[model samples]
Target: MKNSKFAWLLSLLLVVALFLAACGGKEEGTKTTTETDKETTPEEEEAAVVDEEQVLNLIMTAEIPTMDSALATDAVGFDLLNNVNEGLYRLNQENVAVPAIAEGEPKVSEDGLVYTFTLRDANWSDGSPVTANDFEFAWKRAMNPDTGSEYGPYMMSGVIKNATEISEGKVEYTELGVKAIDEKTLEVTLEKPIPYFLSLMSFGTFLPQKEEFVTSQGENYAKNSEAVLYNGPFSLTAWDGTGLSWKLVKNDQYWDKDTVKLTEINYDVVKETATRVNLYTNGEKDRTSLDGEYAMQYAADPELLKELETSVFYFKYNQERTGEKTPLANVNIREAISKAFNKQDLVDVVLANGSVPANYLVPKEFSFDENASDFRDVNGDMATFNVEEAQAAWEKGKAELGVTELSIEILGGDTDLSKKMDEYFKSQLETNLPGLTVTLKEVPFNVRLDLDTNQDYEIQVAGWGPDFQDPYTFMNLWLTGGGNNQMSYSNPEYDKLVNSANNELALDPAARWQAMADAEKMLIDQDFGIGPIYQRGLMFLQKPYVKGIVAHPFGGDYSYKWTYIEGKN
Candidate 1:
């Protein structure tokens, strides 16, 4: 009996030991599997961090309304379309016009009245061959009076043959200067020589559109990403009609795809400064613009960037709002309002950026004459602040307006900076001009533009950047019945000066400069057609890794074709 019990005990002990060894092996295998799942491969580790070289993130103050080249009137739309569409030429990193869809420089006639362009072998994003017919269709569509294109009539008038006539309903759209010689060749005849023709052709207004696609989309055209076709280095994506965010992805079909380093560009509309700053701090944004006190706060940041541009901001007093005959119609009231506010104080206190007080409409840097003198220097300051003079003018204007107490609404932008500046204007104008009551109306940028266009505001705080590199760019805005002249202010003498500058005096550079200078003086100093505020100073933050982005004075705001990110991973 004792031997039988000992045998059973030995067998039980051996079975228990075997079970323990099996369990140990299972645990070892389980630990190895878990570690394998947790560990990342080299490729996986690389993707865990942002690939800065392939992606760019940015913020804008407002949303782009439309990407259609013909209808785009704002800087945001122009900038967006400039990236997604290619013209005959494009502004390079140096902002010099360079061949884009064109094979090379256009063949020009001796008289400089005609240009012939040969299209390159290129395909749109839809894989359709880009031909000269596309250019012809797009140009005619822009010139067609029925298209209701504001820039087309303004840009081509007095430049392209019969363009002015077509715009004025005296001729057919087919009479416009642009024509397709063949599938590959484009011929353009000019009414006269335009010295800046090539640069003008590089603008968004000059980009080509496919006839069928544009017709098919019709009213829905350029409202979203799918509504438009792209022939540039990048193709727009993920843009819902009114969304705040969108993406620009690299176009593999682009002729210059090899040169495009950014695979994706992400843009978000962030109007609030605090939100923009927060995004930048969180590494969610690679760049953001700063204004007012934010400029001062970010001035100490190592990544801070400052760019003083040719754009100017001013106040436009509308004399044609529907409800009432405004006091702005009286010259004495306009003059009083123009001189009531201290521009230096506005720039120093409200702007706080590097922006300079603009006493004149045209900015100081560009518009040089044969003597190499700046136009602003020749005209000197057009408007200035003088409380005593303003009060005296206001008293005189009160009698002229037949109102002892004048209440006016100042229309302004909805941004925080815009509000601050508008408030400052109200305070100063009310304080300086006795018996004047000021009200404020702040709205979104697009709404403000519409209000300005309809002449539906009493006083508008407005801004304009150069569309081309000329003093005439600023001078032409206030021409009688001009497309961009939202204000009702008009002077026949001003019209005469601008016409002469663009016509007979065009060949005479010195005379043209003088004419523009005189016109500016008549518009601002003598007439007070608009109140000049400041030349904008942009303060922003750019990551050290970002490179090769170009900020142009004319055309679009930035050229990101060569932009790339580095050191992200």
Candidate 2:
């Protein structure tokens, strides 16, 4: 009985020893598998450390009016077009005109009247080769009178050879001096030597459009994202004509797509200041413009950015609307309104975005003379605020119009900030200029643009940013019967001065500069065709991780070609 018990105990001990050995082997095998699974390759390790989605979300104060380059007249449309289409040149970080589609510098004629450009091998978004014919077609299409392109007639009329004649229906569009020498070469002849012609190439009015694509779309050309063909670093997407939101995706077919970093960019039009601020604070928006109280609140924020742009806002006095004369037609009345408003108060109290009161048509520190002196410094202030002067002018204007009281409507934007500013103008004008009843017409940005185009408003609050790095952009708007002269402002002296600046004075740098300065003075100080309000100053919040956003003083307001998302997961 003792031997039997001893054998049973030995058998139990052997079984226990086998179980412990099996458990130990299983644990060792599991650890070996885990270590192998954790092993990372070089590429995998780099990706793990640098994993970030290359997406950007931004805000726009107004919706884009149109995507068609030739038809776009506002900053929103132009800015969007700048990203989705490549011109012969594009403005760089320093506001310098850099070669975009053109290869290096152009071969210029001795008289500087001709420019021969050699295009680099490029492709449209459809993978078709971009030829010089595309440029010729786009340019001529703009100049076609039937196209009724505002910017086409305004930008090209005086610069390109036969542009004015073509726009005036005096000559065929083919007569305008732009030709495709070959598949990769283009020749452009100018009416005269334009000092800022190279910079003008970067303007939205000069972007290329594919002939086949544009023709195929017919009435729907450039009406939406799918209707347009992109040739730049980004392709516009998700825009449905008048939608409030849009997206820009990297164009794989772009010539320099390898250098593009951002995969996608999203844009939402948030007109309300509170909504824009909330979007920025909640990390929903990467950037937002701050105005009024928001501008003051974020004055000390680390992410706050301020830029004094070369844009000028003003009151456009319409002499006639729908074939009937308005009270603003009287020079004294225009001058009274011009000098009545307190521009300093408007900038300090309402804007508070570092904006400065502009007493002249051209903003300071923008255009430089041959001696590098600012145009504003040389010309000094004109038609500035003077309550007494304004009252006296108002009385004289009333007598001239044979009226005891006069009522006028002022058209402005429908945004919260615009409404506030317009109210301030109404109060100031009524308080300062007696017997003046002001009515405010608030409309969307696009509606305001249309009204201005149709000469359908009495007095409109308008603004102009430089299309190129020249004072002509601002000065030429008041030219007699100019395309942008929707106000019926006509002055022979102004036309003569501007024409001389671009023609007889083309070769004489000093004379051209002085002529432009003189024209600006006449328009503001003498004619009072437009009342200078303030120079634009932008204050916005930007994420620290959002990098390489190029803000330009001229052309498009911003460029996202070099922009990218970094240090954000």
Candidate 3:
């Protein structure tokens, strides 16, 4: 009996040992699985730690309105479109087209009218495949009269065959030049060979559109973040359609996204120059705008001074809005207004950002003439500052219209600085022209735009800088029936001059430049569609740690893409 009991105890011990061995094996397998799940290499661990404590905060001088690239026309629009979506080509700081979506520089057909681009299998922020049809759909829809797109004619006129005619009801939108050779290739044909054609592509009109989203959103298209898809370095979020404030977050699906280091970009819409300056001065912002009284104050600050050399500022008038502009309608009156407003005075006194006054459409330092100052004929006819001469011309304008009252309506920006300038202009106009009373109205940015485009107000004050390096960008607005030609000003001769310049003179750089300069003279020295105030200088106050920001004379068109905030703890 004792021997049997001892054998039973030994069997129990063996069984216990087997159970312990099974449990030990299970723990070992579990630990291996955990390690595999947590297996991040040192490089990846460092990347994950980026912005671990907080997001990088980037502040802009304006608010973002929409993420949809197809319809944006303002600076905010340009920023979002440039960052969140890319076209077949993109512009460098020099406004030169570089490959962004295409395999490389596009191949031009024998006719110079057709453009064939090979795609690089880009994906949307959502990881959806980007196809050639996207470009086709965007180009076609832009030309469709039903789309009511103002930029369509501005961008597609010469590039997309029949694009202008179709938008104007002469041809069907389907007849537009863009086509998809396949899912990976896009082809576009032009009405005429444009020398600045590639530059035009850098604008927002050439960016791709999702057909499904366009059809689904309709008027509300591009009105919100959720309604859009982006393939650029970032996806826009926290942005309203109104452009009051916004953010651009990294797009994980971008083909060349590995180089993008920004975690979040913050933009705030600030129209008041003083307010913008305060945001930067108070340490509340890493980067902010400078305008008006603060412009010169920051000019001496080396950090801000570097950016001020490259911006353009001008005054755009809504001619249709001015009812009794009969007197102001005279080309003499337009010229007089140009002469009466002492641009230098505004810059020296009103603008502290050290903005220089301008008398011409393009800046003296722009990319047109790199070897020399862009201000050729610095002794040109338009450079004279003759308030007394302007007074004499105003008298002639009054006599030509036979207006006894010589009344006019003027629209100005709603900001505090604009109000002050508007007041000064009012006093100056009354002081300069006898019997002329210029009624002043102040409106917000969007409403001001409506009044300008719809001709709701007369003599509205506005400004424009080029979207790219070409003068055609600014001059095209005055083309007959142009969406931007809020002034009912048109001349066949002027249109012919500009069109011919684009076609015949495009390849001849010197000749083309001369032609464009002549066209600018025709508008300013002739039709008087707009008043040149001051070519704006780019102004920003950023802490020294901010790096990789380059300013172009064209505008802030791509500064967002190339800029990086360094030491962003």
The positional error of residue 286 in candidate 1, measured at the CA in angstroms, is 0.7
Q: What would you estimate as the lDDT of candidate 2?
A: 0.78
Model 3 misplaced regions, further than 4 Å: 1-67, 93-95, 308-312, 317-319, 322-326, 367-375, 378-383, 507-512, 552-556
Prediction 1 global C-alpha lDDT? 0.76
- lDDT of candidate 3 over 496-566, digit per residue (tens): 87666566655565666676678778777666667777644445566654444434333224445544543
Clashing pairs in 1: none
TM-score of each model, paired residue for residue: 0.90, 0.90, 0.83
lDDT of 1 by residue, 306-406 (tens): 76777777888787777566789888898899899998888887888777899888777645566777777888987788888788889999998778999
If both were scored by lDDT, which would come out higher, candidate 1 or candidate 3? 1
Clash pairs detected, candidate 2: none
| TM-score, model 2 to reference | 0.90
TM-score comparison, 2 vs 3, better candidate: 2
- For each candidate, how many residue pairs have backbone atoms clashing (under 3 Å)? 0, 0, 20
Which rank order by lDDT, best down to worst? Answer: 2, 1, 3
